[model samples]
Target: MMQLENLQPYAIVEDGPFLRIIFDHSYISLLVDEKSYQFIPAESSEIFINKELNKVHNLFDVFTFEKGEEILHVTVIDLMHMKQFRTQLQQIIHTFYEKRTMIPVAEVETIVQELEKENILRLIDRAIDEGEEHSFLELTNRLSEYGGKVEE
Candidate 1:
């Protein structure tokens, strides 16, 4: 029996020769024969499934198996879980977009400070060439405040 709460959002789509169930970060493909079904996962996807859903015994756990049945079936519970999972995924994606649209203030401040330090260094170099002792000393002091070193 599969637990509904642990289910993640997925979509079934036709690949060239197989049907693929794609999840947000991974996928499993199914190849059906006359009497049996084969579940296959790409190398990376197998690793992800193993790491994320440790309780999964096989990739076909998404489908229900009954005694004396050769083919796997999707139960009504599976559809309900998929719907709920899709809604949860939609909410999470919306939240991510909202956060991404906000300004990154700290990164902007760091870039501004780096530009200011470079400008001060250039001014200090100009003061040195012009033999302006007071300006050179003042620029050097300001550079020190930014934790920048003047290389000889």
Candidate 2:
């Protein structure tokens, strides 16, 4: 449930208290008979059952959801590890965000030389700042012919 939207980085464990999970500012725990225990990274009822049943003996007719079907013989260690694997997992998440896109910048001096316009330098600067691929390509193609010779 914690992974449905936001993920948590840490978890708390209770030995004899009601099982509960807290994220941010909300609490998700279960209390019964004034006794509860909370498993970090919370798991489903099936995982919990598998854990308890496996401890005494292998469940031959027990339905399991691990592989989408019921299976017998779930190890207690497997259940414990399965319940709290987030601690070993990286919690970094990259949400959808608006960021300034980077446009490929190239020195197009060769294309600027071909432009017959007196403001060739101005045109080149505009092309660089425009951040448009087609515009820069077209400008360079048009200016490729001039190859202005610098007067020594």
Candidate 3:
């Protein structure tokens, strides 16, 4: 079994026709199959399950590793956002790898931060469009702290 001690944050890579996640060099990669991915909200402990044999199953339950249990729990919206973010990041990683050029570790961090800002702005815009006053106020306040400009 692979040790998880040196596991780094996930980064997407294209493995032939599938996109997979590499969690540092020491761990086994996780394949990204959006069709089987699931998102569970923290507020509700319950997840949807169709009764088959008194078992509760979720979308994520379709995948399994020999020695790994649940490694993450996130909201459904966040999961969707993550999928989008991974696709963007994969392009950057692939470019650097293909060119045989070294990209500074710090650059990766900056990219992540910028992507986060974009996601935040998107959420704020969505809230505004949906007429969610509380969500807009909260999201905009958070965005401003990140030096993001909010247009009234």
Give the number of the best model, judged by TM-score: 1
**Top lDDT hit:** 1
The parts of candidate 3 lying over 4 Å away from their true place are 1-101
At residue 151, what lDDT does model 1 achieve?
94
Better of 1 and 2 by TM-score: 1
Q: What TM-score against the true fold does each predicted structure earn?
A: 0.35, 0.20, 0.34
User: Candidate 2, clashing residue pairs?
Assistant: 17-36, 18-36, 18-37, 19-37, 19-38, 64-70, 114-143, 114-146, 115-143
Which residue pairs in model 3 clash with each other? none
What is the RMSD of candidate 3?
20.4
- lDDT by residue for model 1 (38-147), tens: 22222212111222332222334344332244535653334335555445544544454466567798988999999999999999999999999999999999999999
Which rank order by lDDT, best down to worst?
1, 3, 2
Please identify model 2 stretches exceeding 4 Å from their true place: 1-117, 148-152
Over 33-141, each residue of candidate 2 has an lDDT whose tens digit, in order, gives 3433232322222212212222313223221222124222323344334333323221211111112233334435544443454465456658778877676666566
Q: List the residue pairs that clash in candidate 1.
A: none
Estimate candidate 3's alpha-carbon lDDT, on a 0 to 1 scale.
Answer: 0.48
**Backbone clash count for every predicted candidate, in the order shown:** 0, 9, 0
